[model samples]
Target chain A: MYGWIWRRLPGNAWVRAVISLVLILAVVYVLFQYVFPWAEPLLPFGDVTVDGASAGAGAGREEGAAR
Target chain B: MPVRLVIRTFSELCITVGAVIVLFVVYVLYWTGVKAADASDGEIHRLQDQWSRGRIELPAPGATASAAPPDATQEPQKSQAPQATRGAPTAPTTRSAPAASAGTEPARRPARSTAPAARPPAYRDGKPFAVMYVPRFGRAWDWPVLEGTGVNTLKKGLGHYPGTAALGGRGNFAVAGHRRTYGDPFKDVPLLRPGDAVVLTDGASWFTYRVDRRAYRTVPTDIGVIDPVPEKSGFRVPGRYLTLTTCEPEWGSSHRLIVWARLEATRPVTDGKPPALRS
Candidate 1:
């Protein structure tokens, strides 16, 4: 399995730790790969959507938004 | 010396050294892409603010064309808004400073004529932001944070959470990344059930949000999915809320995945040690 390969093809634990850290961030990215198109409809949330872009006051800042 | 004493000393040293090294690496990476990253960070912060507020009065409509910032303390002039030239040109000029404030502080740009057509602005201010990393996936391509509209940035972090909304002027903080395949930042996003933690930090504050509930609402029909006020926003305003969204499997999941979280706690991010990031 890929897990076995990963464990075997390693340097010292420090290098592995860094690699593991990267792996973790990658998994976080996977969540992004989904439902963008669907969620987009809510984009303007409550605004004037003229030609696929948002226009208005609030400008649409949400939670985890500024992240 | 007692083994316990020696072990404790060693562990503390390791942690200190580890923290130093992490800080060092973060500094280097930041230096390499300070302008872009910090701009994006500012944009995020700005939108986060806008979620509750509005454009903080535009600075003298037309200041100038363009210039560079000189001091380390003064805010970077529209530091992150330059990227706006492409996306939303309606950006107001402002100043920002990086959170690092270490090494060469992120230089500030001089105020310029608010370009009519701005590019996708990055962060609205300079806030030390850590890259969102997820384990259990590939090593080469950890998701990168971008400066622009919230949805796009969320995509860089992962894919858009199917049901959540992006940070902007909206009430609820909705984020989306990816699920499975191609640098899956939110691969386990579906795994996040209610009561689980969805952490968001800007290398400044670690905001802990507890997942309360998750449901699949047809993206277009789900108005209250992100209800910022949580009371209405039903063609009316509402209290604030949080939503984590993304695709289901990978292939064909018409059903949008949504995970709801409530603000539980917040703590400032250490100098360079931003708490681990999650979607």
Candidate 2:
């Protein structure tokens, strides 16, 4: 797949390399600023701590305290 | 170009875009936290400077003694006045005589009653109002509580929900922060057990809240957790409540993690550190 793109380039190696780099950066910038934030609500990718840990850790202290 | 060559080129472009998307996720989840932490730290330092400059004040420890004589008409209600003074000094008074005189009148009223009356420091959208210390998170865990939850405000620190009760006021004082990105101010929120103290100081007094319960799951649209009488907060009446909320599951905003704490004590900053903060 990559070989085909390299062959289709209008210029030599350096020009193709520059074009590739620019395209990659543009793609990254658009995704970072627009696409990702828009899709964030639909993604399930932010939790760093394990689930149920707070409940388990807080249970004993909660019971010990009188409401 | 040949059909096979065109197909190959398109596939290659797809692969590159796919890789870029993956990198974008990393930038959002990790890089933003790094940048937000730097911004939040800068805000925290600025607020600390403001506090140190005497812009915020707790009433002078003995101001009430002199205040009693001037407001003699309030003598019947004087007993409860000292308690209000215990938490706030009734705006910064430059003159000792005037401060004492002013203190007596407000002291006669309830702290919550006078809090809203005093002109609170004009909090700009991204400005810090108070500094929150969650000892349960760490000895060094502190975040500047900013005025609003706008995107710019969250980048700096925890954002105070607009239209909610002011800190230490009569209604629910609520704040929202990022759970994972944006410095992860509430990253360890789940570790807060019942009875854990969440202390906030706006340079005048320390308002300590005792965590009553932790609501592990609430839908993203659940605004009830921030209500004056928050649903599932274990409170039945209107009172001073502090609601700390963050995105749940550490990585996603599929739900919210809500922690409810009731105002347990309000002490003048002059009284030294509250016991919950005794290191």
Query: Pick by lDDT: which candidate is best?
Result: 2
Predicted model with the maximum TM-score: 2
Candidate 2 lDDT over A1-67, as tens digits, reads 7675668877888999998889668967787788766665344433211122221122233222212
| Clash statistics: count for each candidate | 95, 11
How does residue A45 of candidate 1 score in lDDT? Answer: 24
- Segments of candidate 2 deviating more than 4 angstroms: A1-67, B56-122
Best by DockQ: 2
What digit string (tens of lDDT, one per residue) describes model 2 on residues B124-183? 666887889999999988889987665556667887766667787777888877787767
- What are the per-model DockQ values? 0.03, 0.10
Instruction: Tell me the whole-model lDDT of each prediction, alpha carbons only.
Output: 0.38, 0.64
Candidate 2 iRMSD, 1 decimal: 11.4
- All-Cα superposition RMSD per candidate: 19.3, 10.4
Model 2 is docked with a DockQ of 0.10
